[model samples]
Target: MKTKILFLLSIIVLGTTSTLKAQKLKKFGSSIEKKIGPKTIKVPYTDVVSYLGYAAPGNEDEVKDGKKFYYIYVWVPAVAPELGVRMMSPVGKAKTKNPIKSEAYTKNAKSKDYFDTYITLERSDIISADNISQDAVDSANWVILERNDDSGEMPKQPSGSSYNSLLRYKSDINDPLKALTVGLYRIGFTTYKTGEVKGTFLAEVAAPVKLPGVVMAKTIADLKAGMSK
Candidate 1:
């Protein structure tokens, strides 16, 4: 009788642990649906824009900063003329100049005329148009921007004007997505003067993974053990 009781208790404990693990994993991802453009901007232009939904690792109310950004990764399988990408703020203006063609846009960027802010990769330098080869998609120029500033003011440009256009925001306002002010922002792509070629491109957003402190600690410990030679 005691053996049967012990077996049942073991089963109950194992089932509970499995259920907890599943719940923890689910908390790390939240589904989102957002897309913009494919509308013709000019009278004869057929500019198309499409966006892919990305899952952030937490609830919508979570605050995201420079350390924790909602990254957008773009892949263009074919090349086209006059292609440019920018992030549009909720107020219907380009928040930053095109990171792909920094030279042509630097004059405006320096004056803080068109866009007062910009985004850059946490890992690598922005991929410029000159760097992309015709044969393959340039993964190096993938879209990653810092979150917008909270001060409602344009960040001050540096002295001597050796503009690091990629670094636009003050350090304090680096967290662009705060739960209270979070809203849909557009990641735009323009393919100009290409008549009916039907070139392909993709855009996807990446949100950080949120895990409980205990779960995160265990994950770290496991990674450490695995890495130890």
Candidate 2:
């Protein structure tokens, strides 16, 4: 036991790091590299010509029983064919009520996984120390994301931004090393957006995120244990 503890500590020590801008841990077996914030905005969401989910023009009327949903949509950038209506959506989740074949659109379907398909900004401040206790993330509008030429929200979902479970701390020392504990996050998704699983989806469902040792540990474990229900 002592050996294991020491090993983890050693890894943390040699693996710890802080940058002038943001503190980040070395990609040791237990940490994620972060570029701390007060970050600049490169792509204002306005660049998104058209969005599909509830986040589009008519968000109010998109809900049912206090919920809204959005799906894959087309985005026409200012740059013409350089980028056309590229389809996008979250990946993950086996249809709760169906036996349909796997769909590539099965990409990250988590309430949080939004796609801007066009150029967007970095959605930093994802989870932080203070508001970490507030399980209101899923309903928290949208997160600015940055990939290549595109970045944007997960497109509002019909969910309350609620989910099957909520993220929580498993220990006195919140395991920043892993994802938000082991339970399913109560991400409120609008019924409309989370459509039935079909053979063909715009994008694939979301895959589990493997952010090195720390984040992947619990997620992988939960998956192995038949979580994500």
Best by lDDT: 1
lDDT (Cα, tens digit) per residue for candidate 1, span 83-159: 22223211112221211321222323323222222333231222232332322222333223343222122222212
Instruction: Give the residue spans of candidate 1 off by over 4 A.
Output: 1-45, 52-66, 89-117, 121-229
Model 2: weakest 10-residue lDDT segment is 19-28
In model 1, what is the error at residue 216, expressed in angstroms? 30
Give the worst 10-residue stretch by lDDT in candidate 1: 210-219
Assess the local accuracy of residue 186 in candidate 1 as a C-alpha lDDT between 0 and 100.
24
Per residue, candidate 2 scores C-alpha lDDT tens digits across 92-180 of 22122222222222332334443222222211133332232223333334332212222122222222121111111112223232323
